[model samples]
Target: MIVSLIVIVVIGIWLMSMYNGLITLRNNVANALRQIDVQLKRRHDLIPNLVSAVKGEMKFEQETLEKVVQARAAAMSVKPGNMKDLAAKEGELTAALGRLMMLKESYPSLKANEEVNKLMEELTHTENQIGFSRQFYNDICTKFNTKQQVFPTNIFASMLGFKPEELWELPADSPERENVKVDLSF
Candidate 1:
């Protein structure tokens, strides 16, 4: 009876440990996503400054500017916790930004503007940071997902209401995936 009692206690402790580990992974994923959100917000805030700086110079490219503004608005409208929608909107914004940047080839004066150049640089840096944060979030999510799908933990995970997270992925044919061709013939 004593041996049976010890076995039961050991199993209980193991189960608790698994549950705690899953919770930590879940929290890590949330933290990572928050990092992405911060970077994205920075990018969104920088867009207006960038648009204002380039507006006067790129008068003929009004459509391009409009697209960028629209995309930014769409991206900002997505609610937090909706990663799938966020990713889709973000991809659209990226494509719009790409088109806006490409206009540099047609408008040499805009590209040469120091303020515009600085804002573009800041936006690029923020984009990279967002990418890294998304990667970290996906990594943690994968670990958590695997833990929840595997043997003994799988049994308890469902009981505890753990669900897999959606990864931030661009669609296969998204223009955002294409290389941005910059014309440096200035």
Candidate 2:
């Protein structure tokens, strides 16, 4: 009876440890996603100002400007937890912004304008933040998923109803995945 009591105590401690670790990992995954969301929000907010700064100089490229605007709207409308849809919308926005950025290379005045240059720099910085946040989010997701899939932990994880976190990824065919072609020739 004493040996059985010790076995029960040991199993209880192990179960508690697993539960706490899984909870911490799950929360980390969520926090990582929230960081990505914050970066995306910054990007969305910056788009209109950037577009306004360049609108006059790129008068002929209304379609490109409009595409950026529409993409931003679509990205903002998606539910925050829907990673796949949000990623696709953001990809469209990124591609549109990329085209807008390349146009600056063609227009000497836009490149020369201080306001446009500053806004462009801010947008570029925000893009870098977004990229970094996405990588962090994916890393957390890998940890959470691995925790729920490895060894004896897997057995208890499912029993506890902990589900795997999804990693954010752009589809292979996404235009954002394509290398940007910039022409420097006047």
Q: How many residue pairs collide in each prediction? A: 0, 0
* Tens-digit per-residue lDDT, 87-133, candidate 2: 98999898999888877888998888888889989999999999999
Q: Which run of 10 residues does model 1 get worst, by summed lDDT?
A: 102-111
Clashing residue pairs in candidate 2 (N, C-alpha, C atoms within 3 angstroms): none
State the displacement of the C-alpha of residue 69, model 2, in Å, after optimal TM-score superposition.
0.9
Q: Model 1, range 1-186, lDDT digits (tens) per residue?
A: 999999999999998899899999999988888898998899899899998988888888899999999999999999877877888888889889878877765777767778787888897898789888888888888988999999978888988989987777887776688887756686
Alpha-carbon local distance difference test for all models: 0.86, 0.90
Which regions of candidate 2 deviate over 4 angstroms? Answer: 182-186
Q: Per-residue error at 119 for model 2, in Å?
A: 0.6
RMSD of 2: 1.6
Clash pairs, model 1 backbone: none
TM-scores, all candidates, are: 0.88, 0.93
Winning model by TM-score: 2
